[model samples]
Target: MANDKHEEIDPRFKIANREALIGVGLALFNFIWWFAFAYGLGSKPVSEYHYILGMPAWFFYSCVIGSVIMIILVTVIVKFFFKEVPLDDEGEESP
Candidate 1:
């Protein structure tokens, strides 16, 4: 016996998936930025390293500044791109 029944998918899942992808993209970008700066500048010998605000150039840019940039970027992304979806099913009638 084969019974066929199709269930409708919740539209909220699509929105959530899009938001999740955006978050993953941001994380990938953050990792790339950190890796590039950390290795690109830190590859030099300690004697040739430059200091920024009393910290090594690579450490300052890759850790301190990278964190600040990520914070601002996430803030802007959430403020402008993310949608506010209601979590509760408000108007449905119970069976």
Candidate 2:
């Protein structure tokens, strides 16, 4: 019956859904950034080096800028969206 399929979901699953969405988004972003850096910059000629600050532009963008962006994103997402879950129900009584 339709009612059987509509049984109440556990509360932990609600939190899990939100966290999974955020994680998937972050993973997609990482993949896109990785591809862009590898193909967009890595495709250039080896001798044609563009320096940002004594380092190749590709390195600067992929390593420094990309790292900073990822760090900021992770920090913001974890701080704002992630919830702390109990490791174990040590103190809770069993039914």
Candidate 3:
């Protein structure tokens, strides 16, 4: 069954699948961090504030600094981990 023609996998498909899984992992990381920040520090009283860049520490880290980090990470991921795959049907064989 493994040798069957129908079981053959394209290299491009494998690359695409890998990239998708990595994207999902990054998204999950972001979600967990956001949830922890929103419920953890956000539950505290207002007078407990420590400011960074004129914003509350939690908001600055979660929204501003986190965004910058994510942007850099995503740029590196796309530049190094992803491949350009042809989506055209020109090379496909028709029965």
TM-score of each: 0.84, 0.71, 0.81
**Deviating ranges (above 4 Å) for candidate 1:** 1-9, 92-95
lDDT of 3 by residue, 58-95 (tens): 78777777788788989999999889989865676653
lDDT of each residue in 1-95, candidate 2, tens digit only: 65343334345556877899998999899778867876688789978878888888777887778888889999999998888877565655543
Where does candidate 3 stray beyond 4 Å?
Answer: 1-7
lDDT of 1 by residue, 46-86 (tens): 99999999999999999999999999999999999898989
- lDDT measured at residue 11 in model 2 versus the true structure, 0 to 100: 50
Clashing pairs in model 1, backbone N/Cα/C closer than 3 A: none
Quantify all predictions' global Cα lDDT against the true fold.
0.88, 0.77, 0.78
In angstroms, give how far residue 86 of model 1 lies from its true place. Answer: 0.7
Counting clashing residue pairs in each candidate, in order, gives 0, 0, 0
Stretches off by above 4 angstroms in model 2 are: 1-8, 85-95
